[model samples]
Target: MAAADREFSPASSIALTVGSALLWGVAHLATGRRRIGLTLLGSYALLVATILSMVTLVGSDLLTLAVQPGWLTALTFMLLAIAAAWTVVIVWSYVLVRPDSSHPGRRIATIVAAVLCGLVVVPTVYAARLASVSRDVVTSLFTPSSAPIIADDPWNGRPRVNFLLVGADSAPSRPGVRTDSMTVASVDVATGATTLLGLPRNLQNVPMPPGPARQRFPSGFTGEPPYTPGLLNEVFQYAEDYPEVVPGVRKGYRGPTLLKETVGGILGIRIHHYAMVDMAGFAQIIDAMGGVRITIKDPIVYGKYREGLLPSGTRKLSGEQALWYGRSRTDSDDYVRMGRQKCLLNAVAKQADPMTVLNSFESLANATKRAISTDLPQNLLPAMVELAQKIKDTRIRSLNFVPPLISTAYPDYEFIKRKVEQTLADRPVNKTATAPGSRPQSTPQQSPERPLTLDEACA
Candidate 1:
């Protein structure tokens, strides 16, 4: 039989059918009179238990892969399963073969079992390490962690609303880290009318609550003293100084709460919920989703940044490339970057079809566990999923707070306050305000524009 064919056979049967089985038989006959050692038998049982666990994991993973069928994703699942099996086998074998008071023939059986275990383990471990690292890289680059927040609000007379998700990149390896993306999704329970608002990271001069001032030194300037209160971003730097508040992470803007409060103050609407995720989780989620397809109409090139280069135009983005797409500020200003971020988000939503997502529920669950932090309760998943299922792909709206309507040149603090005021008052938006240098005037033409495809807008 071919090696491949043999490997697929039942493990117990394989042990009995192969050349190794014949060898075992010969050894058994040679030691026929001797009983197996207690230590050896105990070790063998432990080894068996480990093998059983590995088999269970493999079976579970296989079932998961069947639901979510992507070649790369399936391969990753298999590799991890095999590696887990191998690790257990190695530990089992070591325990089984250790020197002990036993008959010489029993000792020989222990040795043989150890050798067999090693045969299965060594290669699996090596392969697993490589696969895991590669998968991690893919995840780190593509997936943005989104924490789901669900709440019933009497104020809005609605059952569900999603928060604008934000995650500060505070990893030491990252420099000049800032809020990478912001998105607000509001859903009406009765009509299921959903509006997704994508806010630019650099909308400038958003209204923030009055707080003590703090300055942010550029990343890696350990000696530079923190700044005092002035802008909202300054508060972020000040928050970092309070170790009790932020904890663990060193590079994040300290004032996430302040930022949230400021956003709420500006929008003039109470934000019912919030979620924060970092770049690492972001990439993982993307990879888990088998990458996202985005049409990039503009020729975007990041001149130089730690995030690296990206050539624009419709392209299939890996995790790393997607990160660059979201974080690219050099090619365009912050407002434009916000648009790109929305585009990426839309692409992710489009790609995450319910059937596909359901099939990869295990992977999605794993990714969610690793990357997301949310106030959303586990019990709400069924309702959320049901709501999401009803959402037609075409009906989803992506909104951006941009120039002509909202200027980036103004401090974000002021801009956000105006935005909140407008939102709370249920005022009509001036779409023409998006045009550069155009004053936002109240007019009948102020209805928001339909979703702009990348071809029309990005180009």
Candidate 2:
């Protein structure tokens, strides 16, 4: 056929085919395949409309759906389906508009179209993989409570929800898990304000709430034989060893259940949930986040004979360094280390921004799965994530029952309760106005009357 009689020039056909990889169906319409072209266009428009409508209607509840393993699995398959459909469209479009003659240009156009198809599939496949990983993580890490506080409300319509963060120290050399670090994170459901109450590991005479354990230790914890004089941290191993004392507790939750009751009794508040991380696994988590940045006021010494040293100054520390920063007690008492741990928590929370999380999500997820255990129901994750976003920038208030204010050997339980009540009652403070890279203004010297923010404690 004469050039004028043909539908399009070779170059024009090539352009149309390439453009179709992006515009879907345009090549078909340009090549007189009107029926197929209109169908593809209509399908694309409908998909867009449906997505927009879902977003508009669902709003924040979309996150609620995200936490469901079933939904996530479905999402992975759906993403794959979409990728397949789109790839088919790209190839079909190229077939419809490719240059008619057997020429080098036609071969080149074929190669270009293949590359474009790959570009479209690669990212979607990656997204599908992420969705699959998320499903596995949710299933393995979170156990949905058979009995939630409320059927509809994740926070159970409470003003505040308290979670006990326990850093458990369990080694082959040790008999059972030890609650090395215990902090209660009480969060205001509405405002996302939080108060962290840190309890020293060596806290003695910890009162237990009314229960079987309470019945046994009516006069507060005072270490049983083998475990030695009862310290606050010993409660975990004690509970683990004597499961009959805390009967009816979940299989793996006996220790946490008893510890929760004990801590709640001490704080005079109902502990809603508990999250425990192995002290060893904490390092992996830190590494996953690419390390935590902290302002070390003085050199920290760790290891037997003080072989490890974390020098003073503002430094970005690796997983091991952060572990030492929070755990070291050489020349420093537990009170000082408690302050350092609070600072470390604050720094990790502030520095692990969304981009960092996204970039290292796989490693972070893997480390998190191995390192942590929690009684927080899977259904509550969406709400927890929502709350975290709200409070990420809010200054964290802290109350450490250490030294001067209260002796670890004889903690004033009544005084501790009053301070906890006071801290929670106070409105959550905004992030301090301290200049970047400089020390935060010191909190009025730790008095019985005042609590410290992370900034103040760290400073």
Please tell me which predicted candidate would have the highest lDDT against the true structure. 2
The top-ranked prediction according to TM-score is: 2
Candidate 1 lowest-lDDT run of ten: 213-222
For each candidate, what TM-score against the reference?
0.51, 0.89
Model 1, 1-459: lDDT tens digits are: 532222221333233322222222222222231243343344446756876886787653433222222433555566667545544544433333333345344455455555666666666655454345434533432333254434453224555465657755555664443555666666655555566666655544344444432122221112223532233333344455554434454444345555565555555555655666666667677887888787766666642444355555677887767776776667477777777776776678778876766556557656766666554433344344445555643355555666545554443333344544444334754432233333444432355444444334444
Stretches of model 2 off by over 4 angstroms after superposition = 1-10, 56-62, 146-152, 427-449
Error of 1 at 79 (Å): 24
The residue-by-residue lDDT of candidate 2 on 222-338, one tens digit each, is 878564878889888777778887897755778899889889988999998999988778889899999998999998887656778888999899998898888888888888888
Total clashing pairs in model 2: 2
What's the residue-level lDDT of 349 in candidate 1? 71
